[model samples]
Target: WYSTNLHWLDALRHVALNVTSVVTTTGFALGDYSLWGNFSLMLFFYLGFVGGCSGSTAGGIKIFRFQVAYILLKASLNQLIHPRAVIKQKYNGHRLDEDIVRSILTFSFFFAITICVMALLLSLLGVDWMTALTGAAGTVSGVGPGLGEVIGPSGNYATLPDAAKWILAGGMLLGRLEIITVLVLCMPAFWRH
Candidate 1:
């Protein structure tokens, strides 16, 4: 699924068309999940994290990368406990190299860390923890909006403090461009030999 394959994209598009029909009911309808209490809130959080597939307009960490990371980490752990055993990590029927596995894990970890740090910074700027955290995650993940009373779809970013707005704007840029693309451009090392 990580390949730049057209047929795979077509298959994904077909599935998306089907799922959109079931999950999305009416446009611009933001249900008041708070009425259902904490259960709805938790469910919404989980779904947001599960996210869309790679190459789609949808957000969150892509499925294929998750599969690759999982395989690599598990195999790595197994090797630690059983050095004599041989373990190979595979994705989409292709074996993954150590470098690719390392890169994916690095990206994923830094992505999560960035969200958390941004959220904490926003909170320091006077926003509540949940509002800042989910807002940071939602924007950084390109999932749009987030849970809680503020910055949710039911709410607007217009009222936020200027600093917070700028932070969220940066988060959107980071998400859309993907972290690696942004970091590479910013790095002094990237400019050198």
Candidate 2:
């Protein structure tokens, strides 16, 4: 929706750059995209969570997980339609084991839950809703700039409260290490082992 006053090619390039930057967790900005209106703001905010492809250094939920989830859903629906039919799951020409699918789905669930919980904690620290939610998402996804006036592309995190900063720091650690790794480390059983 940012096609006003600029050449269409320039606008397309800018938009593509921003999208690639966010998805790849590169954290570059040509301009304060938060000023591009509510729709673009929200769109960029969510794009942070899509992440890059599997095996890449980029954070957030990887694309393969979503593909596997879609495969699982499709197989499930097909099974429902024909109880006697056997469904074999495969991805990229390789047989998809139940364990791998379960792991991917579990990671996806925890990724979303961690973002929501972090957002709630930020809100409790008196941060505004947009800042809290987008900040949490951006940090956890390793996307540098968040939406909203305080932490948007033009704004820095120095203005945030100490507690909020600490929380976001934790989110960065979790995102970089992958949520499951940190969560496993936090368990008493892991320590005992």
Candidate 3:
């Protein structure tokens, strides 16, 4: 709840801006939303990972991946119930190939793992848990601001230790490039090709 007596329209606009900023990884903020309350903080934090649609420049895991995952889960549940029924996998009426499904799932897995590992490394560097976790998520999603006193909307990354900054920087690159691209580039076999 805001203490300022904002008009309902003004409040709606602010909420929309904050949500768009996080979901699109635009990094713009109208205010320090972390001060809004725990619920708003958590909502914005998670929105960073939802991201914009597929094929967009926005960084987190794209919306289509989640849609595919949901469809796959539903299909699996249906298969379990019907046992012998043939279930087709389709997205937007196009038949879904196994390779596409595999790639999406793999990317999602690596995205999460990368965030966790980075968070752990930040913690080891003496960053507090909230900062470490949200910082990692924010960076990996290519969302500029994190949720916390240190790197929240009102705060910048300038105060963070050099090592932590480097870690977050790496996360930003991986997120922008897409996790699989960087991971593949790291393989020795790829160089031999």
Return the lDDT, model 3, position 19: 93
Please name the candidate that would achieve the greatest TM-score relative to the true structure.
3
List lDDT for all candidates, in order.
0.70, 0.90, 0.92
Q: Pick the lDDT winner.
A: 3
When 1 and 3 are scored with TM-score, the better candidate is 3
**Alpha-carbon runs more than 4 Å astray in model 3:** 1-4
| Deviation of model 2 at 169, angstroms | 0.3
**Clash pairs for candidate 2:** none
Clashing pairs in 1: none
The TM-score values for the models, in the order shown, are 0.78, 0.93, 0.96
TM-score leaderboard ranking? 3, 2, 1
Model 3: clashing residue pairs?
none
Query: What are the RMSD figures for all models against the true structure?
Result: 9.1, 1.6, 1.3
Candidate 3: Cα lDDT at 107? 94
- The local lDDT score (0 to 100) that residue 153 gets in candidate 2 is 91
* lDDT per residue as tens, model 1, 36-62: 457655766655555567776566666
- What is the TM-score (0 to 1) of candidate 3? 0.96
Q: Give the per-residue lDDT of model 3 (tens digit) for 1-193.
A: 3644678788788899999999999999997787778889888988999999989999899899999999999999999999999999899999899999999989999999999999999999999998999999999999999988899999988988999999999999999999999999999999995
lDDT of 2 by residue, 1-193 (tens): 3536678887788889999999999999877777678789878877898898999999889888878889999999999999999899899889899899879878988888989999999999999999999999999999989987899998989999999999999999999899999999999999884
Q: Which residue segments of model 1 deviate by more than 4 Å?
A: 1-29, 76-83
